[model samples]
Target: QYNCEKRQEVKHISARIINGNEALPKHWPWVVAIYDSNDTLVCGGALIHEEYVITAAHCFVNQDAHEFSVLLGTTLRTNSSQCNNTPKDCNIQKKTTRKTEVPSKEDEEYHKASETQVICVGVESICTPIQNTCCLFMKDIAVVKLKTKVNYTDYIQPIGLPKNCEDPPASSTSYSVGWGRIFEYYD
Candidate 1:
């Protein structure tokens, strides 16, 4: 059983944490980076299934599903020399020809490494509770279906969801993980 009790002191601050430490590789395997057509980091998402990701609906505001891609199996958002010496063990080749364009050769090399097998997949469709107004904060969740199914690896996995709607005990601890601006002044 997982222990849910609080183990750290509480510090209230801004939306993003200040002076946050970097997470170790594979620490949060379910986390994925969402990118726009221009290959810009737009938002972060959670892998819930082989071909599905969950993210905030607002991320899709004025965005085209076809222009979005999901990257999995890597902890570092930007390419690093650390991943350069590793073997390409991820099964990204099988889905390379789908609607979503694979990452450029440079991008592919940037995310490739033995410790992590990075793969990029295109967004096939997006579903939300509210069809017309997905930008609303209420029901802000959006489910994105990928054009190809991603093969799981040590660095790529789905997060387990709660089976029932039950509040946790008062003493339980909760955590939030995502990619956001590290410094408030810098965009």
Candidate 2:
């Protein structure tokens, strides 16, 4: 009688995009979203290799890989207002040397008012793990090599890794955004 799956996603919908040179573990350079088979959201991932996705490593356990879905190159979870296969009605001022002239203030403001028009962020490449690693949570780190490389586009590209493999300072602020109070944390 109701789309219960959709309702659940509304409560669990926490997805993100990683575009440009944003450093990760908080800010993703590409848009990453984890969803259910019916297109309900769950969490985000940082692309580590072609198909290798580095996530909490605790997110994939107790679930069938076939039941999970990942959508890349978008900030907002639901797919809406995508025209010409690009975002539509975006609310931000998008400027590039390629787009020489800026739109009028009214038009600019109107676009800014729209939530779907901004450009899509990109993740160079990411993948599914060989198996779900949750209970043990062996490594907080994870890598997902893609089944096939994602086609890159403007305003989106691969993120650069830390220059040194060494860990950052403890004072460094890192954040994790995901759905479910059922999450497992690691060092």
Candidate 3:
């Protein structure tokens, strides 16, 4: 019963994600699957509850702190080349040269790059020791905690995973806007 609903739901989400709506902004808050020097997608997770993100347990088995960086509010692909044709308001870039003297190290030239802000996960508790419980299998699923509560802005939001539905919807499409490698390979 639930399996059938999940499958349909997945299809619905997939279609909507691929064919987005005209009224929605492109950015989406999500977990970044940062692979190591060896280049492997270790695990997957979702950001839920302020100060914590959910991910797979195995994602932390043999990974380093530096190797992982979460890029939230992004689409599946990181690159924005294909999204170039998007509206001007969505992308505002200006090239100006300015200099500021720093008290500590050295002078620096500032190029004001106006990009959409980056939403970071706080990651409250990770790999915390816990005793096993019923109905909770230790699988590849964990949460990331954010340092601050995400502002409830129209431009940034968490992906909605509807409950009670057995499978993912096959029509209520959704998409993840990120600076990933979507355009480089797409036709």
Candidate of highest lDDT: 1
The TM-score of predicted model 1 comes to: 0.68
User: How are the candidates ranked when ordered by lDDT, highest leading?
Assistant: 1, 2, 3
Task: State the C-alpha lDDT per candidate.
Answer: 0.63, 0.39, 0.36
Candidates 1 and 2: which is better by TM-score? 1
Question: What 10-residue stretch in candidate 1 is worst by lDDT?
Answer: 1-10
lDDT by residue (50-119, candidate 3, tens digit) is: 3445665555555434344343443232222222223222211221233211222221111111125333
Cand. 3 Cα-lDDT: 0.36
Query: RMSD (Cα, Å) of candidate 1?
Result: 8.7
lDDT of 2 by residue, 92-157 (tens): 122222321233454454333432332322223333345444445455544544434544432223
Model 3: lDDT of residue 155: 29
Alpha-carbon deviation at 162 in model 3, angstroms: 2.4
